[model samples]
Target chain A: MLAAERRDHLLELLARQGKVVAKDVAADLGISEDSVRRDLRDLAAEGLCQRVYGGALPVSPAVADYAARQTVTPDGKRKVASVAAGLVRPGGAVILDGGTTALAVAHALPKELSCTVITHSPTIAAALLDHPRAELFLLGGRVFKHSAVTCGAAAVEAAQNVSADLCLLGVTGVHPEVGLTTGDAEEAAMKRALSARAADTYILASSEKLGTASRFRVLPWEKVSGVITDADAHHPVVEQVKALGVEVLTAS
Target chain B: MLAAERRDHLLELLARQGKVVAKDVAADLGISEDSVRRDLRDLAAEGLCQRVYGGALPVSPAVADYAARQTVTPDGKRKVASVAAGLVRPGGAVILDGGTTALAVAHALPKELSCTVITHSPTIAAALLDHPRAELFLLGGRVFKHSAVTCGAAAVEAAQNVSADLCLLGVTGVHPEVGLTTGDAEEAAMKRALSARAADTYILASSEKLGTASRFRVLPWEKVSGVITDADAHHPVVEQVKALGVEVLTAS
Candidate 1:
């Protein structure tokens, strides 16, 4: 395979396997380990992969800017997003936050699934623009340019008006004790408010985030009814999450 | 004067002079009162004039949006905005909300004036795009298409990050005990937040907004430091506001 195609294949393998050794990826694709390392570094910079001492792991929790993270684990987020999207029922009201993980979920949604999506993310709103079955209720708030998400009093107030059937929490740090957390305080507040009104909350996170923590706490594991990840994620971490009584789905 | 120019002049006279009786406008323009009323009706549709039982008064705050208000009373808003803009000291950061009144103030800013402008209004940001001397910070959130402004969690969070020398609250309902209010609840929250962080707050409202109230209350009289209105507005309501020690600037 061409170097570019090999790199793509290595990335796909990493996503499918959740992690890949540089030597193995290089040998499998007939490329040098140095090239695999360079590819891993590039993917990490884009927030797609977590590079370890010898290999790369797929991004979890979709917990970064969509533009940056979307390019990171393209195949993995897509597969995970597709599996999560299948759970959404038609004519239901959904609240989508601005996060790469959420965008992946939005992208995976079938065109014919009818629902009302309330979101503060401009990117998600733009994606839903072409969705024939989705009725969009865009919440007004203060705009955060970097994340392309709305947060603050206005966003909180608008969210209070919506009692969503489901709220897809994206790019969050999940811990057994801490629940779900994010990097920003304002985002946490908005997420808390969204969760308060949501009938069911599902967290779309990758296994890499299983033990890590961020600055803002969104919710506890008990609040999240479902957890979705890729097939190749660490078995022990998946088991730990499953012990929390949350239905864990893996993208095959 | 050509018919268009004549109509423009007539509108200007009504705006400046506050109200122009049908007979007087007819006499001034050498047209019948019936013809003048016809013009008044046309202007009212554009939100430029207020048709009364006998004649027409200038379009007041209640009847117009910021865009329409700007077009109807260009000279007055400019004069008021210019005076208000002059209050800005050098090397000071200022917060401006989305409203033509605030837009006028931005327009009236001197080219040599150096300050950082933080705003969530795309319209205001687009307006300042050509101002090379000024530094601009756009607060992000979900875009409000009607106002072209972003408000919510993102905007409020961004606004909370800064402390400004001045906050120019846009036109809305201005009352004694109830203070300032707006038609939009989300906007009201942002306006209130902006007011809280500024060292000084000024309400850029027209004379007619005095004593009126919107559904939402933004600030109390004690919170607002100043009010600016047209010079000709001399109602007892103006005196009532002045009695509270809120410095009132009248634009002649």
Candidate 2:
């Protein structure tokens, strides 16, 4: 096969399986592993995919620049955010994650709802300014500009000071096997720290994030209490998640 | 004089003197003390001025809504912010307060300069998103919607975590006699806490705030390192502040 054709085929496999193993792809195409690795490296260099140890994973489309990500599954983000916002019981403390989806969740929260919101995102904190009754806490740390969120030792240590009833965790990708993931390692660590401070954590997955894998893993299936998503209800991956004994909360 | 005339005259005196003593106003106008008190009450009810123990003080225009205050003293805020921004030595840590002037300071900061910024204001933190090299820390606390900053006991506790090289404090009022003040008691406490965390704290005083007096006292004159202002050079308040052994940094 031509190199361009093989690269297209690799992308198709990644979309379908959420990852491409070099050994499997080489055998399936009757090509050498070296050729497959070279293709993967080229793709990674172009920012099309994340090159892994033995293969490649898709880079998260959700981590695009703020303006660019606004067009990435916006309606689906709103639907998923609506469901995530509903999880907040009045008067409860919630740990909110930072991302476009989480920003959507901030917009989706009721104006009169009097819950305490704790987050490390300045953007989220600024969005909640006009919220009449909701009390917000912005955790301090070194900022991660791409996500407009705070991470690092300071943020993690600050997270330990609060006990939250629920955490709405936003990640770039959610796969049945690879679990929840994002594009940055420090952000993944911060999310883990936030989850530990909460009694229950729920995944906020819009349609595009499903069946995709990013560079860093966040939580395993057992770590999250539920998944709030707007993905197709009948999708097999949704069924696969359900089969793992996890509650799947679907948005309309 | 007519009641309308008397009230207007009272406003003028308050503007010139930063406060109105009922006894003095009554004596000056040849009116009953009761009549003067009634007029001051009417003015306070209209939000025209803040009624103090024995008279009234001019209300802070800085405490108005963000949009309304945008048109108020913009040039002064920018000039004050320019001088305030210059105080941030490259590679040093700065504690930034809330309000439009501080937002201006965030804007005035050179994007190429690298520094660590700690703040309790989401608006200031949001403004710094485009700053390429400044590291920001947003202290977690209950959101103060009026000023788009954070305060309360949680915020005061959060202030103790870090030490900064300088603090640029924003307040509604800065009077030599009243010391430093703001509209809300909790916000005043938060500012005091922030001042303690920094080695040198400079007051961000636009022209409007130079001789004003708000309800809550923030800090005494002895506590602050200097005052940055765009108030007239020969303005008695500026001269008075300078005479108190406080460094008066003027922004052209």
Candidate 3:
């Protein structure tokens, strides 16, 4: 096959399965493992995929800027957000992480419900201004403008000062093996700190984020209470995650 | 003069000057103090002026909603913001309080200059996102949605954790006698705590706020470094505030 045709075939496999293992793709395509590795390397260079040890995972669209992230699988984000928002009990406190998905969770919350929201994102706090009943607490630290959230030693210290009933966390990628991950190291630390302050932490992952892997690891799967996503319930990765006793919630 | 004309004349005096004393207004119009007091009562009931002891002062338009306050005095706010922005030196840290005027100061900052900004207003921090090099710290507390600022004990505690070289404060009223005031009591405490953390504090007062009074007193003239205003330099109230040894800066 032509190199370009092989690359297109590999791209098609990644788009369909969310990840492509070199050995598996090589066996299925009747090509050498070295050729599959070459194709993966070329795809990674083009910013189309994230290359791991033996495979390539889908690059999360959540790593983009404020506007770009909003347009990535928006319907799936809304569905996941609605499920996460349902976890908040009236008058209970929740620690909310920063990102486009978390912002959608803020919008999905019920209007009349009175709860306490603790967040490090100024953008989240700004949105909660119109919320009539929720009492908001904003954490102070160095502002990470890319995500519009506070992240630093100060932010972690502030997070320790308060406890919450639940935490709605935003992650760029969620894979059974690679665990939870985000784009920035500081933001990853901030997310971990926020999870430590809450009784239960639920990962908010839109459909596209499932089985993907980003650069920074946030937490081990054992630390999270459940996974919320709009991905297909029958997907093998979702089933694998569920088999580990980590509750998998289908938003749709 | 008829009672209607007398009330109109009183409003005119308020427009010309920033306040009106009953005894003075009565004398100027060949009327009794009771007649001036009656007119003042009617105006106060109509929300046209703030009724103070022995007189009435101009009501601060700042007490209005966010959109309404933005339209109160655009030119005056910009002038004061420019002067306040000048006080921020490169690489210096400053504590910025929340309000429309303070938001303007965020906009007035030079794009190429770098500084550290610690603020309680999410709105202010959001505006600084596009700024190339301002390290932002957002203090956490209960959200005061009316002004988009954090206040109460948590905010005061957060303010004490970090110190700044200067504090650019926002207040609804600035007067020689009333000192500094804002619409909310908790916000007043937060502003006082912020001022204490900074080496010097400058009050950002648009021309319309001069001689006006709000419900809560934030600080005394002795606590502030100076007053930045676009009011006429020769205005008697400005001169009186200056005579008290408090520096009054004319923005225009």
lDDT of 1 by residue, A1-252 (tens): 666786678667655544567876778677788888898788889877776666765566223333323333344566677777887888887777777778878877877788877777656766665676676666555555456666788678768767788888785577767778888898898888887788988777765566668988888787788878774545776778888788888875
Candidate 3 on A180-219: residue-level lDDT in tens? Answer: 9989999999999999999999999887788999999999
Interface Cα root-mean-square deviation for all models:
23.8, 24.7, 24.3
DockQ of each: 0.02, 0.17, 0.22
User: Compared with the true structure, what per-residue lDDT tens digits does model 2 show for residues B29-141?
Assistant: 78889999999999999999887767776686323233222222245787889889999999999999998889888878988889999998878888788788888788877
TM-score of 3: 0.71
lDDT of 1 by residue, B73-158 (tens): 56767777877888888888888888778888877787678778777675565555446667666565555545556667766765
Better of 1 and 3 by DockQ: 3
Q: Indicate the docking level reached by candidate 3.
A: incorrect
lDDT of 2 by residue, A131-214 (tens): 889988878777787788889998898898888999999999989999999999999999999999999999998878889999
Taking the tens digit of each residue's C-alpha lDDT, what string does model 3 give over B1-252? 335445656675675456788997775554689988998999999999999998987787333233343456498898899899999999999999899999999978886779999999999999888787888888987889899999988888888899999999999998899899988899999999999999999999898888999999999999999999999899988999999998888988
Scored by DockQ, the top model is 3
Which residue pairs come into collision in candidate 3? none
